[model samples]
Target: MGSNYHINNVNGPAIFGDNGRMEINNGTDAATLLRLADQLVERMRVESPALVPQAQVIQGELAQDGRPADRGRIRAALETIGIGVAAGSGGLALAQEIGRVLGL
Candidate 1:
């Protein structure tokens, strides 16, 4: 899996994802997503700190998990961000692109 980041507009935080998708919209969900990412990283560190030392392997693992949890989070964040954006903004487009990447 590949990763990409985008901003819905000038006012928002940088949205992150693979294939330009995200699931963070309001401050609450955005915070949750950021928190989730942090938790996942922390969990990975505790469960397999060696991954930290192996960038390539870690990247691959993250990509693999994309199929289940990672991808779902990405989708949710994208929806949230899209809602935050103006109607007909790029958030949905980005989410759609991400879906394409996920082959959903």
Candidate 2:
């Protein structure tokens, strides 16, 4: 069966699904992405210094409140870091969650 989605206290659901695949639209704002990215940086700096630059790119974009995040840049950053961070600590899971929040 396809996974069930539940948003207990959300404003609305933004989901598109068929069969076993589901894609969630981003009801989450840049701020939320920023928070997740921030959390990663704190854990990543010492745990995996090599991935810091890419993580910073994600963090910096989400911190900008004046404009929307550059999805291309953010995706690239995510790709770069996800490769390195995937084998490290629990940070990869967090990064993937952030990507899901961004609807990437």
TM-score of each: 0.29, 0.70
Over 4 Å off, model 2: 1-27, 86-88
lDDT string, candidate 1, 3-101, tens digits: 566555423435554566554543443344344444434543554444333322223334453353354555455445444444553434443444344
User: Worst lDDT window (10 residues) for model 2?
Assistant: 9-18
Error of 2 at 64 (Å): 0.6
- Clashing residue pairs in candidate 2 are none
For candidate 1, the per-residue lDDT at 60 reads 37
Task: Residues 18-102, candidate 2: write the lDDT tens digits.
Answer: 3433566446665666789998887678677888888888888888878977878988988877887757467787778887876
Q: Which sections of candidate 1 miss by over 4 Å? A: 1-69
Candidate 2 structure, TM-score to reference: 0.70
